[model samples]
Target: MDVQSGLPRCSRHPDVETGIRCTRCEQPVCPSCMIPASVGFQCPDCVRGGSGTGHAPGANQPRTLVGGRLRTDGRAVTKVLMAVNLALFLAVHTAGDRLVDRLDLIGHAYYPVLGEVVGVAEGEWYRLFTSMFLHQDLVHFLFNMMGLWVIGGIVEPELGRGRFAALSLLSGLSGSALVYLLAPPNQPSLGASGMVYGLLGAWAVLARYRRSDMRPVVVFLGLNLLITFTRPDISWEAHVGGLVAGVLLTAAMVYAPRARRELVQYGACALVLLSVLGMVLVRTAVLL
Candidate 1:
């Protein structure tokens, strides 16, 4: 049993908790890192060792670090997310400020295009979700898409498609919720920076889990945080909120007990989502 986690950590992935051991080698193995054997489950190394005489190697299904089934193409969900962002960018370019007015995250603002008040405070709650995909500027779109491509590539493969998507959307929603609660009611914000920052937080958590050096990621995060605070027109609340949500969500995922991994992981996400909804309700009531 790991002294810190109080559970037997997987020998292959030290971050994962497990209750089982390989019959052949007696090394702890998580569900993903072990293969079913005749007598009992075997670790991958033992399965490959085969009969101890090196006669032939045994085959086994590949799994991600978190026990998710491996995919032929790990970046499929990332690609889809990018495509959706790109499509929305093009739509915003064509539709001009009108579409942005409709979708951007705002507390309460009167839009000439709609000839009425709008925003999350006005019961247009979908803006919290849609604003994440709406980038009105070319540079903003490019920067966010690049971040998504780079960070999502690493996180998606390990977390699998569904969990990765959930982390991203929930993080983005958390950012929007913060913006709604803190930013000026009429000051609108729209972009994927929240999601990008969330993924960055996920990356940092993953690196620490593997016992890798922390200096580089710490420096990178610090630089981004510096820019967030110093830069003009940046939504610092969104970045900070997404970072916190990502760290909590990923911790729940990577540290969950092997027996109840999926339930705990998804349940953590749902809890974050519920918290965001509560924020929206409170903020809306105050605005009204």
Candidate 2:
């Protein structure tokens, strides 16, 4: 078979030679032209070689492989959380006190009449989820949103979007449950602070597991817990409950499935949930 004469043989195209050489690689190319890249036309061979391109000679590489992949793009999550908090703040402020009051009806409550936190409480016990999206005041909203932005950025990428969201909801519900059990009647609380604290708690736990330093996180948590205790208006119950829940949930998520490591996490979360439920039942019985 006169393979060379049958088709204009290009050095690169062994099967079907064409009278073309890659502009970049200067290698013979067949009917298929080189793939165009930012720099120039890269022949199939060059392209394949480039696929495994490592860091530039002097460029620094991560010590761990997971470091690069686990690094999260938390900007989107931060923006959305910020916008929601800001919008709620504006709505509460512009709509006037009555509107705010009405909205607070739907907020998570531990009791039938006293736990008004955010939205209209109908029969939807699921307001625990909705209450998370609501905020009481500008200061309250901004503070929580700020924490969300900061912590969400760190945690979302590590835990992934779905798990991060689940943790937030669970933390918030746990906080509200505590408030319902421990706080006085007619005391209203609303905001994402509980969830924020939860994230912090989760981070602390996760950091411990990943062999990352937890001192800074622990200091921050301690300071916040102190503030909650000192400040009369702040619900310590919610903060403590949420914080505990966050740590437990984080442990459950990060270490639970690996051997028997999750046993501690599972036990911790179960105990907290059951304790909160028991408290709620006791409160209800006493009130009734």
Highest TM-score scorer: 1
lDDT of each: 0.85, 0.62
Clashes of 1: 0
Clashes of each: 0, 9
Candidate 1 lDDT tens digits, 1-288: 636758788887889999897655556889998788654587877777544332233324444666565577989989998999999999988888888888899899888778999989888999999999999889989989998999999899878878898889988999999999999899999999899889989989998998889898899889999999999999998998889898998889899986798899979998999999998998999999
Q: For model 2, how does the per-residue alpha-carbon lDDT over 78-197 read when each residue is reduced to its tens digit?
A: 567667767877787777655444444132335434344332233344444445667766677768877888888777766655556667767877887777666664566667777888
Worst 10 residues of 1 by lDDT: 51-60
> In candidate 2, which residue ranges exceed 4 Å CA deviation?
1-72, 105-127, 259-286
What TM-score number comes out for model 1? 0.81
RMSD (Cα, Å) of model 1? 7.0
